[model samples]
Target: MSTPVPLPITWSPRRNRLVLLPLSAAMVVLFTVMAFVLPANWHLNDRVAMVVSGLLFAGVGLMLARPRVTADEEGVTVVNFVRTRRLAWAEVVRVNLRAGDPWVILDLADGTALAAVGIQPAGGRVQAIQAARTLRDLVDERAVPQDGSTTAQG
Candidate 1:
């Protein structure tokens, strides 16, 4: 049997942080520098606008980097770019990360499949697989029957 995945774990995209965070910081600095270097003829409003634009870019970048999945004994919490969802163990029916899929997806009892963008293959398929398996193991271990009963029916 496969080993069980430890609980109270959090998963996020490593490659995304490595690539995006630095790029966002660099863009902010570059835009600010560019604003000051603009021709003297440019109005102060133009410089302020440029700096504001840079700040906005950084804000959006921070949001993009926020995707993450947290699992504890009670349930799973998925935080996407701008949305967060909490699902009980039984609410999840399946966990899959098929080839070419951007991220892991959880099939819920509500008949919906939710994308877990926090666990992406960009971090390497092996890592993604590990994360997927971790969640799968948790679901298998904690998920209750759809009918919410532990007893077997004769």
Candidate 2:
């Protein structure tokens, strides 16, 4: 019997959380402050627009940081900037994170590959590789054969 992996593991991009988020926050604050401190000739409406644009910038940054993957016994959920996808263990045939690739890719049974933006090397190559291995193990564990033909006998 294959040992069961612990359920409910989550993976997120460390770069987004640690680097992008803080930079976004700092930029937002700076933009807001600059809006009020601009030249006297600048109209009040222009200042408001500047602040609004800054808020929008933060929104995009937050969206980028939102990507994550939650894995459980049944399946894995991939949440990206604008979309979320759920794949059952059976649907995920393989997980690949090749060099220069932006994120993990899930090869499905239907011959289609889905980008799993949640796991990216931008955070750290080591962490991303580890996450891919964990996910790959989960998928392989559930891919047991119905017959024992592949089992080796000592």
Candidate 3:
């Protein structure tokens, strides 16, 4: 038997730092400044608190900035944070690009939605859209139809 080819799949955070990072940093800075302005006794627990809070914020920042893409003969895999989901080419119903935010909304056969972040919103180069469309077509081609039309409906 021959090895199967991989379907092109791309994954990225829905948004990179336009919202998460600054807010996290603000929280850290706010608390650190608060600790400084407050009286020493009140500040007793502040330093530790700030450090802990800062670390938490930093973790979130890192998570939000992480983006990855993987494609294999079976299907595509999109990973976000601790959650990683995959879809077989036949399982993908359609690729939707019209929305307030940018994402690859995968309509699965089981009525589930798998969204690939950052692929939406036109944030990347022109190639991003092209790549997304190509993947969409590939998924559509392999997708199983529901109404007997042989074409996957989204």
lDDT of each: 0.89, 0.86, 0.65
Across 53-78, the per-residue lDDT of candidate 2 in tens digits comes to: 88889888888888999999779999
Q: Against the true structure, what is every candidate's RMSD?
A: 2.9, 4.1, 6.4
lDDT digits (tens) for residues 19-88 of candidate 1: 7798889879988999999999999999999988998998888888999999997899999999999999
Q: Write the per-residue lDDT of candidate 3 for residues 10-109, one digit (tens) a residue.
A: 5454456566777777877877776677766765677778767777877787676655546666777777655777767667777766545465676777
Question: What is the clash count of model 1?
Answer: 0
N/CA/C clash count, model 3: 6
**Model 3 lDDT vs. the true structure?**
0.65
Give the lowest summed-lDDT range of ten residues in model 3: 1-10
TM-scores, one per candidate = 0.90, 0.83, 0.62
Order candidates by lDDT, high to low.
1, 2, 3
Best candidate according to TM-score: 1
- Candidate 1 deviant stretches above 4 angstroms: 151-154
Q: In model 3, how large is the Cα lDDT of residue 49? A: 80
From the highest TM-score down, the ranking of the candidates is: 1, 2, 3
Candidate 2 residue runs with Cα over 4 Å from true position: 1-4, 143-154
